[model samples]
Target: MQNQLIAFEGFDRVLNYGLDRLRCPSPVGVDRRIRLTQKVASIEHINATMFRVVLDSAIWIEDEDKPAIIASLIAQLHAAPDTT
Candidate 1:
């Protein structure tokens, strides 16, 4: 299985995106929004400091699309800094 790792400044944003996409309700969303997706399977850090988001099971993401999804997330995260 492949793992995707990401990081962000704020934790709330990351949590929200992950919960929303993963279709899992979490209490953490109520407090602070995660900024990014951090470690994956506690193996790779992805050099992230803010938030850690990982799409492990196939339920969360398709095996074929994993790479694309990861790339997109990374691109979006990098673009965010420029937009703001």
Candidate 2:
């Protein structure tokens, strides 16, 4: 049912951010229940079937370092997981 609903969890967090029910981007539906302990931000649910997740804060890399840092992140995303 997870692929049906919407949720995001990572980095030692049991549940970081998610929508209990998709309610079409409204003040009545938007809520922030997750608390992050590091540089990651909680997901922002914008609509009934839409979400925004910011993986990292700007603290890790400077303005000039963003290119390299972004490239590294992209490579990791496209890279295969390690079994060993």
Candidate 3:
């Protein structure tokens, strides 16, 4: 995963992007918005039913809107076409 510092939620957050599905730990914590389909590199695999998206625990503890984030994630995952 490549780490890049991006401004989010009025703070500089270290956002990791690449093929890795795991969210990298950042000092400022991760925002749930960054975990969307565009940012998640393994999204195609997940959408194809080849695997699943794993979220780091920090998101649960840090993101203020975890429930909605989780819900959106789940909906996106389930909305994918079943390849298996």
Candidate 4:
């Protein structure tokens, strides 16, 4: 099995980049299984009102559904409210 992970700072950029990366279809000639996991977190700066966004993803290579799964996770995170 293989795993792939990613992190992003901006909400919009995270979504855009995640989707673009997921556009590639078919992990051909690969025998290993793949898994994907994504997470988003926000933190507030002590001196600033703006919140920082963190996007994380874990995936395994050769997983056929990894792209769609990761994309969905990213979308959900983007839709979530900013806690910070």
lDDT of 2 at 17: 42
Q: Please, what is the TM-score per model?
A: 0.19, 0.23, 0.18, 0.27
Ranking by TM-score: 4, 2, 1, 3
- Give candidate 4 misplaced runs (Cα > 4 Å): 1-29, 43-53, 61-84
Please write out the lDDT profile of model 2 over residues 1-84, one tens digit for every residue. Answer: 222333343322233343322222212213423221223344555544444554441112222222212100100112223457
Runs in model 2 lying further than 4 Å from the true structure:
1-39, 57-84
> Model 4: which ten-residue window has the lowest total lDDT?
68-77
Model 1 spans > 4 angstroms off? 1-10, 15-40, 43-49, 60-84
Model 2 accuracy (lDDT, Cα): 0.29
Q: Which 10 consecutive residues of model 3 have the lowest summed lDDT?
A: 67-76
Model 1 is weakest, by summed lDDT over 10 consecutive residues, at 70-79
Stretches > 4 Å off in candidate 3: 1-51, 59-76, 80-84
Native RMSD of candidate 1 (Å): 13.6
Quantify all predictions' global Cα lDDT against the true fold.
Answer: 0.31, 0.29, 0.31, 0.41
Cα RMSD of all models vs. native, in order, equals 13.6, 17.6, 14.2, 9.5
* lDDT per residue (tens digit) for residues 21-63 in model 4: 3343444344666566666643433232333334444454653
* 37 Cα displacement, candidate 4 (Å): 1.0
